[model samples]
Target chain A: MNVAVTEPVAAAPVAERNDRELAREELTIARKYIGPFPIVMAAWGLGNLVCWLALWPLVMTGTLSLWIAFPLATLNVALCYLPSHEAQHSNYAKSGEPLRWLNELIGYVSTIPLVLPFKTARITHMDHHTYTNDPERDPDYGVKAANAWQAILTGIRRRQPGQPNAYGKLLREKAEAGDETAKRAMMEGLAQTLSFWAILTALAWSGYAIEAALLWWLPRHIGMSYISLFLSWFPHHPMNEQGRYRNTRHFHYWFGNIVSFGMEHHIIHHLHPGIPLNRNAAAYRELRPILKKRGCRLDGV
Target chain B: MIGKIVQTIGPWGPVLFGIGFLAPLIAQSMEAMEIAAPFGLSFVQTGLLIGTGLGLAAKFRGRWI
Candidate 1:
């Protein structure tokens, strides 16, 4: 099922509200937004098991070293976990406690195998969806530094600079100005990332140190970052067209489909997050005619 | 182009596939170690380990392609 669009209109801007007050609103909305939780959880659990079982033998064997295991491991990561992302947005099934449970389950397995907490991921991911590309508000919304050297220097800078990030500045203003929900979201995101790492450290302390590092931390934090950099950077390069269909290039094969989990239909996803991954093809088919009429076409895998 | 084609499918493909084929055998060896308890790692574990290792190494040779 798709992410249900119950109300497609904008709500009031969250400004000057207290945390408790905003949280109450968030809870009310979150309850409605959080759809099928159980099915998503089970599906993710089974998918994770299959991926681990399928590749673990290879890694356990001398035949596949850490290098080979890395890519094969990602075969499941992009495919298996992306659906969890969709589920987090309550797109997997219709709304209910069952949906919430499924979201929690799927979110937990997908990242925890890599040692991230479902609680934190869900919170940050919600921020990501709501704030999409809004540099002033979104956590994942990043900007290019003035130059390559500036960017490199910034990474080594070790502090949120006096010349703040656009998002950081906005968040600072919002917090100082008493935007409770925004402040709470920012705080929760910080807590979530911190908690995820804390859990990872604890897992390492527990006997499964190697597994914890390889399966949990390295892939989620390191490997996925590298993959995302390449995926995002290339697609949004200056040479790419401004038009939707021409903006991104699809690899156009089963491998692409398996890897992206229908994200290759990028434009459609932005237009309608409610469309399920399985239904991406049908959604594209239906929307293409209308979109093309408006001088926009969605590229397919 | 021809060289790229040959490098990929001719040599690289077989080597990767060979590794995939031998993965189960290696797993069997490692699992066998625990299974072969009490008698230091029984002949079964040693044989499986050595056999799988040698088989994979042989497969890596250019002639195997």
Candidate 2:
């Protein structure tokens, strides 16, 4: 007589396990709209250039005074950060394969005005996304300061020697860790900085020095300051340091979204980086209910 | 043909297009200022400067209200 042996139930089949994983992944798919992205970016670039070209002649001729041209130029310069931001995310040109290089090239060219290298910006930005509001770890902690003024002050302080700036220190650590990407970013940063100064020096030697200083250099600095204040500081100031949903602010103003390229819906971006810039608002609308349940803060201009 | 154009020009197509208009404008501005061309930048430098400037402006406009 054979003893009745109870066989243990076999584990879930491999295909079933794989199916479960696929289902979980599908739940995270974001709504993405990429049409008109390339056209809009191109138009913005062309418009700014046309504006500058038109203004330059008028300013030199005294038909349009510097007092007028200066502000307009500053506005234009400040706007340059948006395209570069998109480029950093590799979301500007969303056609197909072989377009990755186009994304990177746009990023680099667009950031030239800010004297920022694409790789450095990208690496630091990735860190910002990862660490978010952690004062000790986030590269963009200055942006999450208690107030806008505090954020600006923090940025200034961090740039000073001996300050515990997470971004700079993290770059150093990454280099020491033998991260090739970090190494390349550092080298690019140095090279870009030098290139910036070299261009300025060349301009000064060429006699268009004053023109370059006033028209080109000064506006970029002002634009950068504006970016730090509005883009980084205000949007992130009220965000909680913990949890993905609580860590970003969403603004529901159409005009604001238009100007900021849907940056106002930053919460959606933080939650889903794959969504293109043009589609952030749509994505936000889709996820609003879930985000609301999670206690995400919504604001407007 | 469309893919070829996009690939060849890449993301710089608009910028290059903008430069085409900007170069002449900068040259005119230099003439108005009576400053002789420096660094031999007659057309190309102006195009670059204006193109870069415009790109920066577009960036700001996109973000700031």
Candidate 3:
């Protein structure tokens, strides 16, 4: 009669043991934020664009001071991308839905001043989500760098003549394959570029160079850099891992959420793209426990 | 033809890109501020800048392409 003994084994940590349970719990919480049509985003899309356009006339006619118009221009250009971004994901309404026109309309018009074509942005953005830290595949992978200057400089470097462009290559491939949407994106992109140069050149010749430079030229460059810095680089720095949870990070932005464009919750956006930009913070708060359990890189939570 | 011109420019591609973008920017700034074009050839500068821009833009697939 031999005595049998239970094998000694270590028990899993509390959070580790409850990972599955927490995921299910997290989904329940996330579902609560799915939608009721965020009208605020629509207002932001239309309002910011109208304000950006109005800058031209106001400054051109000397009705408003360039000193004041400059800052507003930067703010408006930076603000323009988000609403279109929301519309890019069809956050307002799904395809074929009755309100879908509003989504398309907002997507197209909101980015006019920024000189980005919505279809181009949407397609490339979808690719970005699919391959966020994958150097070989992501159109946005060009922005990955060790620091702010590197990331920003890389953006400029990649735009230099004869440099390889990930976005362009991908769009070209898709368009060559006869994807109608991609073709439209390419055309719109060309059109936007011509329009930007034409307007700037025309204004310069017309004696409104200061107005053009302050209101659009400088602002667009600054705005693009700022967007690349916060949206692309900060949220996904050291962009090494490709795992869903590990690819993106939530870090403390000392500048606080608003000045940082609410990007501290960008990890939440990557995880749940359907959540409107404004709701990511609240959802992140509720889903923190599960994210931690999932071994995500939440630095400042 | 633009692509050929771009290739002919060779290593100066970026230089052209810079000049093409900055020439107009500077020329106009001078005009707006009522300063001279340094060479006093504002119209000549204008034509060259436009020509450079069109060349850069032709066969352009993306930014600075």
Evaluated on the second chain alone, the candidates' TM-scores are 0.35, 0.42, 0.39
User: By descending TM-score, how would the candidates be arranged?
Assistant: 3, 2, 1
Clashing pairs in 3: none
lDDT of 2: 0.62
lDDT of 3: 0.79
Better of 1 and 2 by TM-score: 2
Candidate 3 Cα errors over 4 Å, as ranges: A1-20, B1-24, B37-65
Q: A1-301, model 3: which lDDT tens digit per residue?
A: 0222233322454366555555456566666686679888899999999999998888877899989999999999998899999999999999999999999999999988788889999999999999999898888888988888898888777655678867778898998899999988877886787677767767765667667778887888888888998999989888888988899999888789888888999988888888888899999998887788788888852
Report the lDDT tens digits of candidate 2 across residue range A1-301.
1222244323554244344342232234362343335546545654665676576678666798777887887777777666666777667564464666667666776656567777888888888888788777677765566765677676655443234545556777998899998887877776676566556656544545445556666787677667786777666766465567677788755456666545788787677665655577777776665566556777764
Q: Write the per-residue lDDT of candidate 2 for residues B1-65, one digit (tens) a residue.
A: 53365346534533442344344446556776786776777644764687567644533443211
RMSD, every candidate, angstroms: 16.3, 14.1, 8.1
Over the stretch B1-51, how does candidate 3's per-residue lDDT look in tens digits? 533653476445444533444455666665656775545567438645654
As for lDDT, the candidate ahead, 1 or 2, is 2
Best-to-worst ranking by DockQ? 3, 2, 1
> What is the TM-score (0 to 1) of chain A in model 3?
0.91
Models 1 onward score TM values of: 0.49, 0.65, 0.84
**Docking quality tier of model 2:** incorrect
* Model 1 regions more than 4 Å off: A1-46, A49-72, A93-98, A114-135, A143-211, A226-255, A297-301, B1-65
Q: What is the lDDT of residue A219 in candidate 3?
A: 87
Give the range of the ten consecutive residues with the poorest summed lDDT in model 1 chain A: A154-163
What is candidate 1's local distance difference test score? 0.47
